[model samples]
Target chain A: MLFVFTYAQQKGTAKNPFILNPTDSTVVWGSYWSEMPPVLHIHSGDYVRVRTVLTSNPEHLIKAGVPANQIEKQLIAVQAVKDRGPGGHVLTGPVFIEEAAPGDVLEVHIDSIDLPIDYGYNGIGQGGFLSDEIFDRKTKIIHLDREKMLGHFADGIEIPLHPFFGSMGVAPPKKAGRWNSAPPWIHGGNLDNKELVTGTSLYLPVFVKGALFEIGDGHAAQGDGEVDITAIETSLIGKLHFIVHKGKSLQWPRAESATHIITMGFDRDLNAATHIAVRQMIDYLMQTKKLSEADAYMLCSVAADVVITELVDGNVGVHVMLPKYIFVSH
Target chain B: MLFVFTYAQQKGTAKNPFILNPTDSTVVWGSYWSEMPPVLHIHSGDYVRVRTVLTSNPEHLIKAGVPANQIEKQLIAVQAVKDRGPGGHVLTGPVFIEEAAPGDVLEVHIDSIDLPIDYGYNGIGQGGFLSDEIFDRKTKIIHLDREKMLGHFADGIEIPLHPFFGSMGVAPPKKAGRWNSAPPWIHGGNLDNKELVTGTSLYLPVFVKGALFEIGDGHAAQGDGEVDITAIETSLIGKLHFIVHKGKSLQWPRAESATHIITMGFDRDLNAATHIAVRQMIDYLMQTKKLSEADAYMLCSVAADVVITELVDGNVGVHVMLPKYIFVSH
Candidate 1:
């Protein structure tokens, strides 16, 4: 498949006149640029593949069973090095779009995440929300054995692994700037949704023409809130396909798997995040299923639920759940 | 089955003093005044029968479903009359337990929730969280059909029903007085956990000698944050069974089901709430499992998740999740 990509070089300046803020929108594209859009349109079962550069090059790892303290020097050694300049987080254009648009929702089907075992557990501290505390003083660099498939806990509790990308967003609008890689906007950049796992279809709002989207910052595994900041941060190869729904507009992103309809809301405060989540779910019910406000509020209380998507991330996010089985769509 | 109950009446005062401020070791004996304790145990199939009173029984649902203009008339009607003090939250508790003590954990298994149809929906005035300005000026009395589920949304989203208890706790262990039954304390009062549904196993930290636990404030349905400040308030008949696990000191209450382990932490601030949740989960892993501190932290980052259990309730509460399928004991 021909995957389109827009490379933002460090020395290059924004051709567009709009000042890109880190919060509002996440992507900027000029009309005169020759490179293709980031979004890829494909069929449900189509297999799409793309590779990404490491956030930091010269990434190091500890051999299996090594003491954690030994890696202290290695972290200090690599903290200041900028490997590929600022030209990171490039997007693979709308590769598979049978039907997608601004008013419509785009469902991305993620299949498998391929990891390169060479630099297994390196490049985790690239400066995000919790990077200073977790990577600087707390955790250790470790490798994951494909066989063990277990996470370490204090008592005897073993954690499981479910990995996905950190930043995956479509271009905002033709007018919005190629925004910073910090906040999540309409086009769905830096969403950091944990449920974007295998067999999940993420429904994103399409703002720009052709939904110029991109997906990178692959994580091996991450907990909700990403409190320690960095997950199993590593370069990964992801295979997925996309389907777009035209003439539809979603206020925010929605995720659906075998379980429920997930409505995502990210904000600075927990309550604000909660409000966004509740409001969107209420709105979803109103528009998609046709319920009144009072009924919608009640439904949210009963069937719909609110979840703290991430509390420790720079921005706390709350997700509202609407179990699909409860209300079947006609 | 004869469920052993301890009924306590104040000797000089009208109300039970134990229900207000519970001591870490004495409140249990206070809530229950009967002789020897029986098997205060409840398992999966057993149903626990509980008698509950109204939240504002003295206040009454005076102007329910009444327009804003009629509220004055409704209050005037009540002014001429006085509440004989029979309708407010009448908890049949201080249940006597033989094996529960401070540092012990009480496991309450919810079997079923039964609600009254007509008198279910409670009304909130304009000053509450979801003020009348946000909602409507009139008192909206939501009627629930016990036979059939009820939920509302704006568009067409139909909601399913899942009923639960809003205020279920062992009284506070610090101070003594007529404490406002609004916030959650060390004993877990007013902790509106929506997931406290059937098939859920809830674990509360035992503070007093016999665990002076009183459960009431049944809600037909409620969202996670309970942002509107009120749930589908109703008088409920709860069928629950209790089991006591000794020699365990959990800092907060915990809940478990077939799929996940929920550890709860309550605090006044969101940050503090999150810390309580994280610390409690860490404590759980440490006490139950055999992992180290760093490993536990990593495990939390990779597997354990924190949730905003009750945000609007006096103190913001967080529920950390430990998925069960990943770590099961043989």
Candidate 2:
């Protein structure tokens, strides 16, 4: 797998980008470790066309009503690897960003996300918020109307598709060792925030050398809490533009979409997460919009929308979305 | 004060709504009690053009940067309300919905919400999410651009207005004496869910005879979480059409907007509130959409957006929003 990696460490441009395919060697099963060797190397401002595969069992897909022929061959091909999880996702890469270092911020612009397959699965099982009441462990195959970007959940139920990667992060600090990929931390793994779709820029604090970036857990569409445990799980292809901001610092992950500035916090306690998210937004507003601490607090109360990013992620997520239109000159 | 109420019971139509003003006779300060005398008795499907008053001091409004002349006189007049709270709002009515009874549901259709004042205030005090960190309690009066439907928070900050009644509901169960008008219960007071704007139907469970309803704490605009403790608080006039669903029942407050179906949960713990909201949505999808228990839970995971309605309201609010468009047949 390392033989297929682009290790030249040359500057990659928009026109000529490094393409990565989801293979057993390039993908890790259910863990984000600082020791994971870099699969590819690219310079700042370079674009990477990355492909990701789902982690669910291929036999389960057929049981869930997906035809055998429709399954992505890469997903079936990658399943033979014996390595699996302390978590449950087959994430692609620990792509090394050459100039990135600790204490800096790595900004990843999610340029586009397109479905690689025309079907996805939603499973309900134990370990969700309603795990006590709902004991049925089953999966349903949802046919994706890729052209229209809708999921046919049932005859009458059609879910709108907003495809995005559920996990995107760099390796944690060396001391943290192989971090379980279930909970998101300051390094930004398994965020499960649906707002980081195409056109959004996710800013994560670089925790180690090369800012070992990784991405996977494709969700065609997902609700805020991901309360039932999974989203419309499927394979996806995304064009990510990576840029490392030298000397810049971020305590937690922050994202900015075209319409709003979003700050996120992940913790077992939702209120503690909310406090972190709100404080981040206040800090953002104080720095960029140039408002006082009090004014920023007041502005967030009156203007920002705080949403549950995902409740089931070990460290449940809370995000504060502050609209950018409000910051315009009169 | 009692003599000013419209004692004659009557049916109100869309063309001829019974007008209820915000005088001491019609408004109750800070409580939702079953024993509170009904100010107006209206039949099912009655339209009430209700006028509401702000609860803040006029002197504070002036201190918050509003011109003294712009302050609504009704707000100043309502200050004599000595029968104040276990909460702080001065709300209008315990208006009797004639056919409503225990086990029934009172469906209040918010037909229209119009700003009656040109200015609103956002005050950050001692009880907010960051109250411990922010000690300076202050208020800022924001200018409302009624024509453009914006609130000028500052020179460059303009908040879009989505007017709503922060507190709205019937009396609690007769056994539960006068309840504080702060935390929302199954009776639905101070939901602070910003999505309950115009063109929405709020279905609240009826706990007492007549389902004595009240409304107040007009917010010109408010974000989710209401972190700093208030929105753009001001006076508003709303056109409310009340219909009593006699045979229907609801466990918690459920609402439907033009675009989505909403379910709410309130608790001091946000996670508990989230559990309640998701379960309510699951129940809702199961009952209305006729999906099996398993499917409903799965559907919520893949489609519903759980949002924080308000964090400062003693019992923090969490609501699940399921888009209505997804429920239609192909």
Candidate 3:
């Protein structure tokens, strides 16, 4: 069974007391949100659904098929949109998991992504990486059809759309502070893994009680670094399932697919991030292949690899991979 | 015919400068470096053989099949092995191509890589991203086998081996200046593309006469960023064949192979780096698909993607590609 949470209409604090911080743990639970706090009970195989919001001003809306020119006008009219309310990613969960705990890795399996027509950000603006010289206009409004599987830039160019969430994190440790959605930490936030699409299993470190997890910031598509500072920001209704492993201390996050073993690295500098990724992979290698640390490091330098995760985000993330064919035990 | 260059000796001078500098145009004529430079006078479709060096302190050495204690003793005996010396990354160039000229991108198709036995290093120390906490001892020592492939850690961990040049650049423009061989620039220095193995076609931007290109600093393998600030630095003997195109203006370097459309991005910031990469790919996409600029840009954001090129080597580079299956000419 899958649980779906849509922020259709929000009530008062009496209904929802869980302030949506990426690192916040569940305290007073109410029925304001769709999924309740700290208990996503499921068997070895069960499907779950998650809904997310956009990172733009809620009061603003771009009707279907709005041209780039008029979109500029609307953006200029609402330059100070942030003054109206709290400015940050607001997650909608703490989906209680009956069988999650510290030292164990929570496996989140994503199934599908559904986006409504009235959802998703629609614009091409300046100040992005390419905006340095390419963007001439203030805004290029985009109003894509809900069924549009691809977006067009010019007459002959077509792009395939792959939508996924930009933010997904479990509650931090018992003592972990309130976390923002800007960076990726042990609990996992803003992990923009492209493969996190349909049919991928993500393993995250569980720190807090019951793993009060939340996910949001859905993106239609985003590059490795989200270099433009924004991907096709969109609201998404996603179906996901969960399986909890008890008493497994994951120093960091691990992801597995049919083809690869990916360890996500989060840090401020690229070198440091890459080191963490490489070391973690080495640990995996040691456990599976029975090699020494020196050999693992050498393997990383020669065979395994490091890839940049996201550079445009506040904190940098890197990914290190150990191809699946090498590990025979699995 | 193919050309190979091996530095029998080192002679640094203004006209024949040894190091590569970005601002300097004189040292721009080179591409990809193994142990030394390839010999001058390479022709299209010709195979070229080259040599490489390892990052070891010349002052240290160890016998074949030495015991672990002996290896440890050698490592503790020496320090300061990171520096390679003034006569570093020598190149072979100015082959005087009949059809090559300014503005065209020279394509270097890598053939194969082979290593010599009795390989060793000076202090495989702690300096990479994980140095702060896990500070391993540094030392210089030699190994018994030149064909050393893997380094063991504990159990279940084994790494693969892939080697390539760390430095590759074209001859400096006729304008004149000395150069440094640390960063990759318009001339493509220290590109370190792992895909640059045998059967890969690398396109280098030509800025001067004869494209007097050169290559050096070969490593068995390296992660995306070379994040530890160093790879498995080693001396090597490699082979390469060159083909030059005349009168074609390529803003940057590009590569193509049977399964990949490799566009390289080098910049100070990740955002700019991604923009450059996506822009080049957009250009490629437009040229191949007959799409306008707008369409190409949109396609890039949606279909084409960013891959971490090298984050550790002074500058950050990204590779963006659109799988061939995603687009086919109508």
Candidate 4:
């Protein structure tokens, strides 16, 4: 028998200790702000269930002929919130983790991400990445098959879905001022890395007290580079477990899945970004795999795959993926 | 029960028509030159069994403790070629093809790449891809298990091998002057794309008469970026089928395997290069799959992957890979 499950009901069973809803007024719409108040405060090693709305306006979706019944009610309510963004994404929260301060790392374990709807949209704009090459704006509505775990694109084409949050970050350093939720930076907002699906843990450096962590921009499926500037943009409910590492600090976002360790680098210059990713990967191998710096560097060339995360993001992203299977011991 | 086999005996049947060896004095060392005379000439749709030596000096290999017996006699003799280049790669040839001229496309189908030796080397120099990040120069000899199709990296590490020619291209336009083999331009030299393995076909724009096609810099295996500037550098004997497409013209190199169609872009500006790749991919999908430009662009975002081919190439390379499976009809 088919049954509907609510986030509250899922959390009531004690599977999730804290649940943060996007409907809360404290939600930061469009941009990340260090000065924004925390919506919820929790300690290290706490499991928080969070929800996110697609980075789009309900009116736009309806205008594009999306069925009214399929429109998310929470998203409709979120549009009425007075406090919004200086940017474009409807970010969920800057949930604070107690004792998370500078010189520490906030490790986020993505437990699960579920699509609340059976449809999503992909948009391409004239001013987006590759705009010079493709000078046109377009949007596409895609149907998602939950059971098949696929996004039906055309008559015979289907995209295998691997849902993940496009944006996940702690607040920027206090002096960085308000940040747009588009270009990913040291703070890790809008990473748009398709590989950070379920079973992955994202590690971001803590810049301020309590590590105001935020998450949003859900994508049902995406290829590397997010070439057309969007994926299957859809609303999502996710469960994340946060742990603050006291002595550990990171310069950029790092992630690990069941089989691969991921290191990311972002900069306006792709070469510089690539360098950052390779250097970060070398550091990871040296620290975790206990390889010499030279060996790590050489191993990166022979083993690790450096992929373009996204070119659309103002700061282009590059990520190095090192398969864990290559390591003999662990 | 194991019997020794020679290349000639292996091709005893009427399968391959020409087998070109590298020991011939007609090899082009280091740089690609339009003036370099063709070593061999064949008509369109001809099969060539070409052999390439690893890009290293025999003296250097011996100094690195590679067993003298393991060094191929052809490589030792190739080092004596006086007409070397301003670069460092020991490329095999400028095999001319009849009826191939400027404005036409040369299709090189890679049938097979076999490693003649059981070992390979990976080197990291001071001026390669991640040179700024890694200042030291080092090289490591890796053991290859041909039967297992893997490169043994260390005690607990094994690298799966997918051998390919790192440098494959036709002569650049005669007016461009002598071109260094390092940067991949419109003529497609030193692409270093790991996906161009066996069963793949690489299409290049012909810039001159006979399309002086050259191929070398064999790699046992490589990651996407070739981050440390080298893969498991090794000698390879590959069989290639050349076909001339007089009606089809291309602005850049394109490739297709059994499952994926590949488009490449090269520029000093990675972003521009990426844009070129995305544009080319969209164009390809529209032309081959009968999709509209808008649909193809969106399809690329949802299904295709853009990978960093290499950053060290003077003109950074980006390639868009669209899985052919997306199309229902072959």
Candidate 5:
């Protein structure tokens, strides 16, 4: 209820949105527990301007050469949350959506992502794709150029900036108990898929009452595989609009960008992950395009692109992006 | 000697170029052998318009419901090739480039690719990503709309047309002796990579004197993974200009699209293959971008994209594409 005053001050009504900032009581670290209580209650179609912080501690950021003045006070403040757990990511909520029960779908419309931070860091340690062969355990501090929308990577090199949340999900099935935030599954945590940028709508299936949802692990920019096990890890603020679809169901999380329909899968083996993505795509085509199973499978081979999302997570990921333009005039 | 009259009439000299069509005597199916003699000899800076035929048997194409007239007559005539592969692909070369010796780099300038065929096929077979689970080994014949540059994949589905030669490479090292054309290696054979479309230049490391170059396995369009183990496998013709860089040396094949510099790797293990691609990209950045090993490694994580080229090739493939736009004013 601490957010009530802030919500009212921001003129948050049933029709209007409010702001949710990370604080000691509002943020959870490392793992997701189904038993965790919600800190806020909101109705469907509500827009929340939420602010999330990177998992790195303020001490670490400053040690990595980030200026103290640039560090968000909220990040330093959240360090008092002693409940931090078995994992490392710091997530920002379990917002309980009223009437969102099991079997429902949570449609997250990512309206905007604002980047106010000027720096981030990429650390290379253990568990990366090539970590065994090339063990260079080091971290590089990358400065972001807001005007050019790029990262000053080296003396003569620059990287394009595409900001997005690397992790977002609801509570897992009750029987699963506490879940680590390291791997993404049916709950969709730590997807680390770069395609989930702004203007994308991620449809995640609801598994519990109220459909408690949380988001964090921001990336300033990342390549497809995240081969080194890190991106331009940074903090990001998002304005998200949530809609609860009561009748629809989805086996795997799906996403839609401005120009394409996206599907995802995660598995220990990259080959199996690829298979799951392709099959999900075929299922999507069969239902939406009204094509026979045979036709959908063939179309996937000739049309849709299945790309590696991340290879470092315990469960590597692969996603399918089928351009919406290809389904025109139907 | 047999092609002397044809070469002279077409003015196929050091500066000028001529066409080489696939015939029973000119084409080699499947395996690539270093002992294979060159069918044509040309100098550096020379252009060759190479025509290739699909490896499908004409009778099988007709049985799969493809119109008989749509089958290339050259495909029918190539049945007499007793040297037809220990593999399944039909390649149309062994074009020796004079002075192209080991430690040199052969720059293949792909000026254009013409898709004159009206049809192609996608076959799902064993060894595919999902073959063991989804055992529907059927072939689909797709019709091309030349005017629209699209493939009619289904009753209401249309796929954007992108034509390119799937198999194109030089001879492997002499020590390797006979090599199957199913996988790509230092020789770059059967690199089912779709990024090598029109206007893309492929750079292959020359392995022996008079680099024995071969090209075939055309595709009308394909997704990244080629999950079902095939694309719109079609016959295509490519106009390529070869330039021998006598001083340049490379360890693996590389390519460049209009907007990005590309690196590639192939291995049976996807993880190992990805490692190879990333290392090659790091090597590229260190050499061309003048970056230190640490800077190049960090730049790859922050900038370059590592994508799965194909999962079904005997040696699966991965490629890295670093966009050219990010390097401006540097």
Candidate 6:
């Protein structure tokens, strides 16, 4: 199934780009709707700087007795309209990229992610991933010390901050219908991987033409599993550059940082997802490094690390990391 | 079903201890037989210096054309007897520790692991964890550089060597029969976790009186999954001190390094194992830190990292690592 995009006039520049604000009417709430209109249009190799608010409601925070001063002004200003769909994350965008077509790959290079505020929240509810194991619901507001690059979790506990977008994806195949922004799939929505921080490139398979790329769910810091269903949830402004690789098709999303190449897989079964990720890494090694299949598989066993991105997402996420230093040259 | 151990005269001092050689008659191939006799006996708090060999036949390596000069003399002298059953791991002991009983916990402090030889092998067989994905059986010999702490896998690929015992466990519950040494259970055998290196303490639930602890299957280096079913398998001498916790109980094996506390879980289902590990971490936080369940769970989400130890083992292994720096004055 193909998706036809009615492109809008391009406005963002390579250096000083047009900002897609979360407060704008173009913001999507909860679900990734393939039919959604493109909020902005950009060509491949162009830059688009965007802003995203945490997936929370000012009314809910106020009702829960958070002081008015503690609430982010942006949170208060953004209208919480109920017209969105089947999920709960407040995502920003659906930026249509010119020349990105089906059977191609979209490469997103994350330049920087900046936190506008010095606070964030982590919430655990009865509907969390480990709800069967833990049956309580609570919220914790954490103070971020930007200078120290730490999140003050408690009086003496601190967490190192590695800010990144938890969700970054293109619209799925037109046949998949409107998808929830919770579970990641072939199109790579809500990956919730902490390793995709600054200086990393995320590659997603483009199933639809123009590649309606959306980004949201910012986290200041998060451990691997995201077991409690939330991270240091906060709003963020990110500088991103996009490039489309025509004729390069992928079955699942993959990423690369300075030190490592990453392969990802998502499925309801954790084992199945893990296998997919491992196979993808094996494929990458064989294709890129010119290693035999046996050598690639063995190399993975002795060198690659597989990690769970998030268990709470309906389709559990797994990623295999192969350190680049092992290769003679890249 | 209880197997009584006839104790031998203890000979080792806390500082200078007796060594249990893997080639001695005491070594057992494969299954952890409760009925097997202890090679040595020691009191709680006493130190035991032990030696282990890789789980490959010297004849096989020689037939594969490894030069006779390259093979360690000990490997050639150690006769590969045919009295092994159920599994194929060449485990070195069932060291009897006095005063360790069922319901107690055995705390094994790993003082050091040193390579006696400068080589190791990684093998993948048709019966491996990913056998369906990969059919060929192969072996790759690696050169270990002790001074550099690296395993030279190939011309340019160097794996950082983190030597640790792959299997460390006491005798299983007597009624469980002779258990194969492949899967890790409540008694903790073949965990294959790279984090259980020197200076770490592995805590295993005692299932038999005297805690017939055995250790073997050394690795110079290994990644998380052990996907090809082998690490940098090698022989090493390890110095370990044992202490029996009188009343402390644990449902699964737990460990602590200088920087983190680790909780483990094992199950046929990866997701189920992950849940068990996460729940164990939450329990650990609640009990030790005096935090509410909700807060503990949230803390885990923000600070703890859950990793896959190995997937090839019959019961897949998962471990949750909670960094100790997050706790104040622990």
For each candidate in turn, the TM-score is 0.70, 0.96, 0.68, 0.93, 0.95, 0.94
How does the DockQ of candidate 5 come out? 0.61
| CA-only RMSD, every prediction | 10.1, 3.1, 10.1, 4.9, 3.0, 5.6
For model 5 chain B, give the 10-residue run with minimal summed lDDT. Answer: B5-14
Native-structure RMSD, model 2: 3.1
Ranking 2 against 6 by TM-score, winner: 2
lDDT of each: 0.57, 0.90, 0.57, 0.86, 0.85, 0.86
lDDT for model 2 comes to: 0.90
Which residue ranges in model 5 land beyond 4 Å of their true spot?
A: A1-15, B1-16
- Each candidate's fnat: 0.44, 0.90, 0.29, 0.72, 0.57, 0.74
Tens digit per residue, CA lDDT, model 4, B99-210: 8999999999998889998889988876567676566788788999999988988888889899999999999999877788888989998999999999999999998899
Model 3 CAPRI quality = incorrect
lDDT of 5 by residue, A174-249 (tens): 9878788888888888899898899999999899998889989999999888878899998899988889998998
Chain A (alone) TM-scores for all candidate structures: 0.70, 0.95, 0.73, 0.94, 0.95, 0.93
Q: Tens-digit lDDT track for model 3 on B1-330?
A: 888877632432223323221111211222332222224444454455544444333334333233444333222332323333233343334233344567877887766666653343323345444445445444323332334455222134333456677666675454434454655766777777776666677888776656666666666556665544456565565666667876567777787766778788888665567667878887886787777565455445445557766655555777876665455355
Residue-wise lDDT of candidate 4 within A135-234, one digit each (tens)?
Answer: 6677788899999888988888888888999999988888988888888988899999999899899999988888899899999998788877898999
Q: Per-residue CA lDDT of candidate 3, range A40-75, in tens? A: 333334455555555553334443344444433222
Candidate 5: pairs in clash: none
Calculate the i-RMS of every candidate, to one decimal place: 4.0, 1.0, 4.3, 2.3, 1.7, 2.4
DockQ for every model, please.
0.30, 0.81, 0.21, 0.58, 0.61, 0.52
For model 2, how many clashes? 0
User: What docking tier does model 4 reach?
Assistant: medium
Best by DockQ: 2
Docking class of 5: medium
Better of 4 and 6 by DockQ: 4
Q: Candidate 5 residues B175-260, lDDT tens each?
A: 98778988889889989888999889999999888889999999999988787888898889888988899899898899999998
Off by over 4 Å in 2: A1-9, B1-9
